[model samples]
Target: MITSSPPFFVPMNVGHAVVTGGSIEIVGRLAGQWFLRANFTSQLARDAATSLDVIYVPRRQANLELSYEWAPGSAMTGIVTYVGDRFADAANTSLVPGYLLVGLNATWALGEGYSFQAGINNVFDVTYQESLGFPEPGRTVFMAVTKTF
Candidate 1:
């Protein structure tokens, strides 16, 4: 009778989970703009002790995005994140600490149908954990361009 959790786990033991998120955007004149966004979660681990339960984790916990285009050919965008830890540790793999990530993005219309966008993530590149025993990527830059059809 090798029972996991001694048949007594949490009221709801959500197993390892992975959440995906992203956004789409369009810039117009007069501080006009459009955007599309979405996010989702991975799977849940129902069996731990009996299984590996090494994929336990939690959701981002918190997220935020802000933008301002008060001048012509210029725009500024900002984002914040609070990621929850998702590691392997039986009972609840989602027992990692949370963290905050601040970012700022700017864009300038270089020409018609052509614009330049530059941004920074974790500008501080603060070290954090991506997993239980692994470190997440450090602060990085995000740049891009657009040309409508």
Candidate 2:
């Protein structure tokens, strides 16, 4: 039996999609002055109809952060991140390679809600893409000074 009602059809969410994943996080002190933390995720998000992988959804991703307290109210933090390969489209036609990023930040807290901060990202000037057609930014530096009343 076949019946056609309209030329145009609208898509609706029938709750047929399912995504499963798990993450692990660890935080601890390295020696006495440094704090270390890490996180990892393994996931699979898919569409039931076409049985295709989702766009920009990597199966594996992880990050790490290390902070050192050189003195009171002053700290330096370093971060590392990894994103596994993934598809650009639903059908998985276009492939995007995995990427790693490194960053560093330093913060100094002054008296009376005053602080100074600076950081640099993509320290190696890595060339990569975070999405399909968009190119990710390369080595960037930023700084900020804050005063609160």
Candidate 3:
């Protein structure tokens, strides 16, 4: 959707778009319960093109989250991602935009309503920018713990 009015001139933008492909899931339980779900996704972007310049970005990615929960205070999870050809190119970069990244997350219940969680981004410590020229954190370890009354 594109809308323009008087007073202010908003050149051109991607407007809004969403593109998705599909995925498959395989699950089972024996002695303990486990769940694995995957998703295949793509992006639909609008690159403002005028009489002078033309730009467009097409992003393709696939991600998966495999996790298992056993004891009350123990849960482990692994995240994996894969990018298409475009993302592998040096010109294509970004943690969110078009790039290849992998991360992991884990949680602990703490047994008494108190739980702790942690995650590490850029698992391989791969140095990459999120928005082309912008700098993004590398091999970061983020942790947060919470308790309920």
Best of the candidates, TM-score? 2
RMSD (CA, angstroms), candidate 3 = 6.9
lDDT of 2 by residue, 96-116 (tens): 888999999999998898989
Candidate 3, residue 128: Cα displacement in angstroms equals: 1.9
TM-score of every candidate: 0.54, 0.84, 0.60
Which scores greater on TM-score, model 1 or model 3?
A: 3
Each prediction's RMSD over C-alphas, in Å, is: 8.9, 6.3, 6.9
Error of 1 at 22 (Å): 18
- Give the whole-model CA lDDT for all candidates, comma-separated: 0.57, 0.81, 0.57
Per-residue lDDT tens digits of candidate 1, residues 35-133?
322233333333433453334445334555666665566778777666666544454434556677788889888777788899898977878775445
Best by lDDT: 2
lDDT (Cα, tens digit) per residue for candidate 3, span 35-61: 676777565433233211112233456
Error of 1 at 38 (Å): 12
Q: Which regions in candidate 1 have their CA more than 4 angstroms from the true location?
A: 1-56, 71-73, 90-94
